[model samples]
Target: MNIRHYFDLCVEAGGQVFERIGLTDDYRASRGTGFFTAEHHIRYYAETRVGEEVSVYVRGVDRSDKVVHMVALLVNDTTRRLSCTLEIAAIHVDLRTRSAAPFAADVATAIDRELAADTADWPVPVCGAMGIRR
Candidate 1:
């Protein structure tokens, strides 16, 4: 799949997991803010072919005063190959004020717990044709 597709899939899967665990009310709501303004940094180690089953896994999470950090691992189930690794930093801001806020402790805890419990299988070469690493 392409990088854009992969990113969408990851967001979708992550959103689903978050919702199932009561972390989010909806796709947009899960982001804390209306939607995430993400800064994604990704590295591709391999590639995945069509018809292969890929899995997205959350590897870690951290919270600073203004941002929530997530590390995701995408692996190819068929090839047992690691496709890409992503470090996403999403900040929580008041839309009206356009100012950052300290990440909620409850949200941080939930993210941390879910990430720690994550052990999903993944696909290979998680990135698209683009050479972008972040």
Candidate 2:
């Protein structure tokens, strides 16, 4: 799959999480710019063919007042193999000031709850500082 397709999967899965915390419509309506990606990383393990059954597994890796980080694993269902992994750090922002904005108390609390629940069953380690030596 292309890079955009991978990103789309991440967004869709992340949206579900946000929706549960009551940040869906509000986030969408803030079209002017509500959030920005601070970092995004992807690692590929295998290729997936068209029409193949697959699943995207999302986990909340970490979060703060204005930032949330997540990891998503794309797996081939039939073979039960990993296809790729995506890590993203997104920050809430204020469009007018183009600056970070803290999430609401409820939103922050909800995120913490989600993180705890998701972390309990996390399947993969959320990697950091990836690279290779020649």
Candidate 3:
């Protein structure tokens, strides 16, 4: 599976949830121009195939000034495996002055709520569990 596709899926899924809860206007509007900056890091620990149903669960969100940081986990249903984990940091800024905007309280709340909901039952096997000849 392509890692970029997985990352895009997570971003799109998270953006939808955020919009549903009125976190930001829209992802496109929030991008570039210093309005919003997202630095995403994804780690793929296991192999995943096509046609597998996956779900992205937000784990946490943090805000400092205009920056909003989010952590999320992606799980595959077929194998009940964690396909990848992502950490994203987004900054909110003013389009006009190119300065930081006051952190939106609603955005923060929505992010936290999403993360809490998805992290309920996380199952990832430890490295020791995978059998390998020493």
Candidate 4:
């Protein structure tokens, strides 16, 4: 298994869940912008072997108009344990300007809904120095 693929999977899963308003292809195309990962931290709790069945669960944790916090869990189904957790902070970007940009109204509303609806049983493992820049 490509371990790094987990991060990509997490991003893809999040994009799909928020595709209606969060960083969708239409948004990128129409707005000429997209989301860029600003920070990433992973905490490993257990080893997930190649043959082990693992599920990737990703959810929004919080958001601002320009940034969003998300967490992804890699669960070892065979062992019924969490293999790892990924914390990601991503920013909306302007493709043309190459700078942070605010999300559209609909996107912000969708992010708000996701943040409100998302829940977790465990605390997210985050690095001390990473987050949306003030």
Candidate 3 lDDT tens digits, 37-102: 456667786777889888877644445556656656788988999888766666667677777676
Number of the top lDDT candidate:
4
> What are the candidates' C-alpha RMSDs?
6.2, 4.7, 8.2, 2.1
Q: lDDT by residue for model 4 over 1-134, one digit each (tens)?
A: 46676656666666666575556677788889898888888777888777888788777767877998888788889999988878888888999998999887877887788777756676666666676565
Highest TM-score among the candidates is held by which one? 4
How close is every model to the real structure, measured as TM-score?
A: 0.67, 0.82, 0.68, 0.84
**lDDT at 48, model 3:** 75
Q: Itemize residue pairs with steric clashes in candidate 2.
A: none
lDDT of 1 by residue, 7-117 (tens): 766677656655654545452354544325457677877887778999987654545556656666778999998787776666667555666755567666766677567
Better of 1 and 2 by lDDT: 2
Candidate 3 clashing pairs, residues 3+ apart or interchain: 58-115
The clash number for model 1 is 10
- Per-residue lDDT value at 87 in model 2: 82
lDDT of 2: 0.75
lDDT of 3 at 16: 66
